[model samples]
Target: MHDEIARLARHVAPRRATRVASAGELAQPVLVVGSTLPVGQLEVIFRRPEVGSVAVQDDAAPTRTGIVTRAGLAAALTGRLGYGRAVLERRPTGAVADWSPLVVEQGTALADVAALAMARTAERRYDDVLVSGPAAWGAASTADVMRAVVAELAERSTHDPLTLLPGRSATWYALRHRCSLVRGGATRVVLVLLDVRDMSRLNAEHGQDAGDAVLAELAARIGAALPAGCEVGRVEGDGFAVLATLPAMDDIQAAASADALRQHVLAHLAAPSDGFDPAAWPALHSAAAWSVAGAADADELVAQAERRLRRERRAAVLV
Candidate 1:
């Protein structure tokens, strides 16, 4: 009995020592990754502000994780996932002594980030853990998690989350597999990628939630603007990758569809929303479209579209 009591006391003493050593490191912007600890002590150790963000793992079959901050945790539960807010927490005071504080860069959307955090939590079996990232623009969020899931689905089907147009993988695969059929005649492939401007600011200022809303809205508008017999899926975050063949690939016809797609997107953004405030709209947002013919396959075509979009973003920055 005496030996056990002394051993326990000795174990606890080291934890206190580690905490003391961690004080300076904890003062900076940070992510607190650990499984077990009370929120109150966590706040004190990390000095997180009142109304800060946090998540607690949810106890679902997959294991839903939770952030510990009052506002962030509650917001996530209420479906208002916040993004770009720095995370802070304490290192555990006892063994398994491999645990350390965590910190990561901010992501693009709150919705995406919350989704990722939940994903990580769901994947983890242990209860004594927290996952965190930066609270800056382009940081991860629940919506990002959704986008990732959606993208994965797009790989299987025809949908793309970015532009709500046919994704590169699905589109190219379909073109290669179906375009060669004699019933369809010799196919001409026309691929287009629409590039948007300064999207990072949108995620940073309006918050990831707002940014995701814009992406979703943009994708829907693009999907609706396609020409007859055309299919759309989102392939990337700020670009729409498209593939069509032969007669439809004519310069005039393809240009018209691309123009119509761009105009529709602009009109939608200009249109009033019931809940969106125009006064706080993002400062910069523009679109560019790319077209290509005779692609070997979907993967190659998508790579081409990605290159086009990257070039447009760079040009926009210069402009």
Candidate 2:
């Protein structure tokens, strides 16, 4: 089992980094100028393409002293005698300069960035966050922060954090799609729910860490055994669900396909691992239900499978 998992991991492609750090790579140039620059100079800088806000740096200060936005500059310049006047002379130092801007280090996590950005938005502040570090110095705009946040959320919604397989929502969507294909008279779709027996007992006897390791190993084994075009997801703790589209065939052929998948998973999971007694190898029990595309929705099909699963469990207990 360990060898099989290692082989699968080697063949699996590396996952892309989903942090806010990647968003920095997409950062664009921001406007920055010296505090001594005149109002006319600042006006010209604002006119430049894609320049939104300018960071004002004082010669005596190591960091940015303030920010001058295009709107603030226009307001400050109203009724001014000449464009050559110093910005400070027209609007005063504090009047035109925003003292607060979102600032972050280079390696800030994407999720953290998203949280900060959302807080700022809630307060009706739309200023860009400044990112500073080695090889990174730029402003992350509200758009950039929101984009990263949305991407991170979408990923989290669809994938299980521990197993990295599709979560409940994604699994339901996959089953719905497969059912649609079946309804189009293309092929048969089968939904199979598998439960790991005694998983909770194992966790209680050992620890959560051991249980997590077991779950991860089980996920890998199931993924490796699934046929191409089959979708598998971690539906709940100690339980997995598979949506498979069988070849154009009758009920017997479709049932055969589901049985084959169940056998493959059970066989692989029965293998022993280090530190685990061979007699304690995890046992799996599965129940499958067939569906035609237009006959039932995803929820209905899942309910049918669950009923079958309950019946089987009851029969086992009775025996």
TM match of model 2 to true structure: 0.62
Worst 10 residues of 1 by lDDT: 8-17
What are the per-residue Cα lDDT tens digits for candidate 2 across 147-206?
777777777878999998889888888788766655756366678899877787888877
Q: Check candidate 2 and list the clashing pairs.
A: 20-110, 179-293, 183-293
Tens-digit lDDT track of model 1 for 1-319: 2221112111110111121111122222324334455433444543545323333332232133334444333332343244312222233212111222122333223233334345554423111223343341111233334444554544446555344445656555554553333133323444555544566776777887887777666666555544444444455575454333334345565455544544544565565355666643433243333234333354554565557556756776788
Q: Lowest-lDDT window of 10 residues in candidate 2? A: 4-13
Which regions of candidate 1 deviate over 4 angstroms? Answer: 1-168, 175-187, 246-274, 279-300
Per-candidate Cα lDDT values, in order, are 0.42, 0.68
Q: TM-score for all predictions? A: 0.39, 0.62
- Reference-based lDDT, residue 21, model 2: 48
Top candidate on TM-score is 2
Candidate closest to the true structure, highest lDDT: 2
